[model samples]
Target: MGLSALFRRKPHERAGFELYGKAVAAARDPWFFGPLGVPDSLDGRFDLVGLHVALLIRRLRKDPDRRGAALAQAVFDAMFADMDINLREMGVSDLSVGKRVRAMWEAFHGRAQAYEAAIEAGDAAALAAALQRNVWRAEGDATPEARLLAGQAMRVAAALAEQPFAALLRGEARFPVPEVPADAA
Candidate 1:
């Protein structure tokens, strides 16, 4: 590769940034903060964004080809890049930014594993438990809000599954509108 190529983003990397943007937008949906009562603080926002990014990564990693792996890494890179920028903008000193980003990366991976496992098992209760612990910062039995969010996660997974891998590779993602569970409503 030429020296110029080193500075320029590959096409897949560009698509990763685009996909990350879409996930952030989805994370910002008002339903989560309003009805679901996710905290509006930085930590809350980070968890929400992490959730969306993790879901996308789960889908991408399902591809049997190297393209899937590359796109997943790109998306992961874009997420940490955004996190680093946000930390700096929040006035975290340059020295501590790396430490903070490392912590955030670890936190994201832990939650991603929990969510992925629960979703794969089709175990709503487990998913709700994980969401309660991560998003609501709660313990013991899952709360109503956590259950609702868990339901939303399952819906999102199914929706994402129906979307073509080609579409996601092209930098587009579709998330279902968050729904209130029937019993909750």
Candidate 2:
């Protein structure tokens, strides 16, 4: 490769990290844990981040431009790196961090596939069921908390669908806020 080519920053790498930051910020929104009833725990937070990342990835993959796909891969890499750092900071032993990260990756992949299929099918019920199984795994039934979270998921998906592919390529995606106000909770 030419020296210039080697030194040039990859657009996908820059956009991917920007988009990933947005996903993390959205996932950390307190409204999800408050009015949305997502459990305010480590597992709950991870699931929420995964949900946002999945939505972004789904959108990126659907773009006709090849760069979108590359950006998606970069974003996925960033997410896992963040997870690994989080595990280490939590005092997880180095010997077991790989196992935990792998398990987390597997869980993320499963959810992404289920969510992407549901969104592609345009089946609200399927999306809700997937959310119930993944996000609400601790809840035995389709409780109100699960329902609220499902609704939020649907809202995020729809908002993503409305975004222009070009805007996404520019790392300008936006998610809609839940209809209910956080203070109302």
Best by TM-score: 1
Q: Write the per-residue lDDT of candidate 1 for residues 59-159, one digit (tens) a residue.
A: 88987766988998899999999999989999999999999999999999999999999999999999999999999888999988888888888888888
lDDT of each: 0.91, 0.82
What overall lDDT, based on C-alpha atoms, would model 2 receive against the true structure?
0.82
Stretches of model 2 off by over 4 angstroms after superposition: 1-11, 138-141, 181-185
Q: Give every collision pair in model 2.
A: none
The runs of at least 3 residues in candidate 1 whose Cα sits more than 4 Å from the true structure, single-residue gaps closed, are none
The candidate maximizing lDDT is: 1
Report model 1's TM-score to 2 decimal places.
0.95
TM-score of 2: 0.85
Clashes of each: 0, 0
- Residue 92, candidate 2: C-alpha displacement in angstroms: 1.5
